[model samples]
Target: MGEENLLPNKQIVLKNYLQGCPKETDFELRTTKVSTEIPHGSKGVLLKNLYLACDPYICHLMRPRGLSILSSHGFIVPGSVVRGYGVAKVIKSGYEELKEGEYVWGITSWEDFSWNFYPQQLLIKINITHDVPLSYYAGILGMSGLAAYVGWNEICCPKQGEIVYVSSGAGGVGHLVGQFAKMMGCYVVGSASTNQKVDLLKTELGFDDAFNYKQGDLRSKLNKYFPKGIDIYFDNVGGEMLDEVMLKMNINGRIAASGMISQYNLKEPQGIHNLFSLIEKRLSVRGFMVLDYKEKYPEYAEWAVKKLQEKKLVYVEDVITGLENVVSAFVGIYHGLNIGKRIVVVAEE
Candidate 1:
């Protein structure tokens, strides 16, 4: 095929819907020719992916049929390509709003090349000059970052001196939540699975304090960390951690339910047996999806980007190179194998 007539190709496909934890073998890297020409009157652009986000939400898509899907979030159909947020550059654009060579972050199919797509449907044009790395737009400055902003600002609504605890504190969403709480002048405590993660949370990410949840005495540890009782709990791990946090929640406390990674792998999610505490403590627990807060993206992005420039924001990511390793990188997230945002670099900028 000639340059103007060449087909866009080179993609990763899901071998099948995963039944248990997704493994690297579930995806097959292959090439397929796709038309480079934008269909007549179509408002879309073609892009080459630079960075692809490997989020826990992708794990929800891997579940076998008949198992409870995570919140009706769509999964990768068998033989179809996996999809997620990514940073890409416009290679060809029939759409006036997107120009060639513009950097953007948005929904993208997992591939080296994407055919014509409505980039604006889920995409945001990005500036590459911000102090943060461009890949931050895929995580901290993008979806996962927005997840933290909404969960903290709209849902948790912290105040100065409030005690806030975040589970999985060193992760894509968790790390930001703890830091945002600190920015709001709250007492932030995070629980990580490892000592190194705990250190990153406390020292690098600016958590007021942190502990390794994989170690001893969760309830007692939280109690020891927050002697005054927690005013807000950002529940990411769920299950027993949520239960344990309830034991330490103060009256009128709030819980923002973001994720439940612990239960994602189990046939039956652990039940929370502490509802009685909610009544006695007058606590409120709410679950939120970032899509519900899209109107705030511009405001959040502006503020977050400012923080990044001021050195008040920290972005961390675990990156694995090559499209071939995308499957392994995604699966690693489930085992808490990555720090900060998990990204698969499929191609160079």
Candidate 2:
């Protein structure tokens, strides 16, 4: 490849390991030139990034190394391209399964283009047979969707007429969990930080009731919404909220401990003082990772696609154009600035 033909690749690199809440200054955007051609006998695939999902869990990776369990898997290093899930098009591939011109969604860097040498298992080929939006693979049909499906269906085992509650109800994953519970005939209630999000849940998302967690006492809010006690709790914001919900759970209730957005930025995570209630209520609390349920993705994807086509399911996305705004878009999630799933658009497909 000629040097003149090289493409200018823009990237978002972590400036340092985060100490408190992430700031826009914590990331630095840089440009570098790269050739699009794949090397001979290489097992890598070149990608053109389209949309990137802004998830709260990525904040955990920003913490100092050895501060959390995720550090073992490798934390975000200073002056390196930030990594996250994104939708991309295969530009040049030495791998047979991932052919050129195909779309894939998986773990890719925050750059305009990326080369994945070990994509045999990391990148998942997107099936576009249904003509759905490619961006959906970054949110509703991707990790968020799979996380909600496994947490609600397999872990919670929700039944018809059951009472369910979701924390951070309008988030990327929480929104889907509430919708799934509702589809199963469960009466669902969700909590958000703002009244706008609370209204979106009840009026648009079909939740039975919604509450702004910042407005009143946590226990009072739960009591008002779940007078009969909650049977299923899809916990996205842990810490104090989980502690409060434990006291209001019905006998044999199930709790899916997904993400803990509340304590992600805390130097010392808040302690849960309601374990006694768990034993008293015979509650089952299970912390699950979406990767554990990879085999069931096809099942969930089929159901999600069908519901979407029938207009039975609704997904809202707060999209910001350009990689320059990626830092602000990500930081906004922690502060509850986004109404739904937040996505950064890098390029149009």
Candidate 3:
């Protein structure tokens, strides 16, 4: 639709299935000509990806050699583009409903230009009446936000004055969960990787207390903080963290297993020796995924946006520019390098 100089595209391809922890070397940058205009009579639309949300769960898709199942959450083949949730602008459209210049957010690939068929799944349109940053739709208003809400309300079902502890508290879902817990009048505590993150949780996110998991003894630290034992554990990081929390959970406690970022990269997961404690304490630990709760998106969105408008809920984001840098941006999530929601600003228009 335009001269070669007018349309430029940047893309990423899967180099290989990672053996253990994913490295940036497992992805490669590729470029090609991409026109902003869609072809006439085309059944597919073209989009300029504006933001890419990096989530910890994505690490599960990095299959190791000889593994039969590539991903438990989603299948990703070698040489295919990495997929994620993002916000984009429709430069071209084949459907009568989706017009050019409209903004949409949903599951999208890690690339500059994407032809989103079944727009219902790949592209969920955004109403700009809110006029918040487009990247906000990619994180706080997108899947990560839904995870926080569903994990807390649907899974944990907390009551007022309940003690809530969230692992990876400064992360995308963890941050929002802490705020929502506070809004519910629950006593909240969070665990983060750094002292600055702990400070942010205590002072900014309104947690009752927060601890840096990297410093000192985890069990000793948790015991000191939750002297009476935790009533609910919103687990993001697993392994020893979960084990430690299991030892300190009260009778009839609930554990919402949102994710285990600790085990995503490990070939064999570390032992959770305290599972027996669940029986003695009568604790309930349940794991869930968002797709199973798609029916709740509309209701959850309404509730969350109202909180946003009323200033009852807040979030943070770490944004990088250009599709060229998306690989590194995603790598940051696995390494605890990003403080908030990690997103890549791929292209504006």
- What C-alpha lDDT do the candidate models reach, one value each? 0.85, 0.89, 0.83
Candidate with more favorable, higher TM-score: 1 or 2: 2
Q: Model 2 clash pairs?
A: none
- For residues 145-260, could you state the per-residue lDDT of candidate 2 as single tens digits? 89988998888988899999999999989888899898999999999999999999999999999999998788888888888999999999999999999999999999999988
Best by lDDT: 2
Q: For model 3, what is the alpha-carbon lDDT of residue 327?
A: 86
Q: Write the per-residue lDDT of candidate 3 for residues 1-349, one digit (tens) a residue.
A: 3385256666788888877787899999877666655556665667778898997766666574433221322656688788878899987888777889998888778888887766765567887777467788888889999888899999998999999999999999999999989989999999888889999998877899999889999888998999989999999988999999999999999999998889878878899999898999999999988767778988887787788788777778988887888888888888888887989988775
Model 1 residue 195 CA deviation (Å) reads: 0.8
Cα lDDT of model 1 by residue, 130-192, tens digit:
667787778988889999999999899788989899998999999999889888899899988
Shift of residue 300 alpha carbon in model 2, Å: 1.3
All candidates: CA RMSD in angstroms? 2.2, 1.5, 2.6
Model 1, CA-based lDDT: 0.85
Off by over 4 Å in 3: 1-6, 35-43, 64-74
lDDT of 2: 0.89
Question: TM-score of each candidate?
Answer: 0.93, 0.97, 0.93
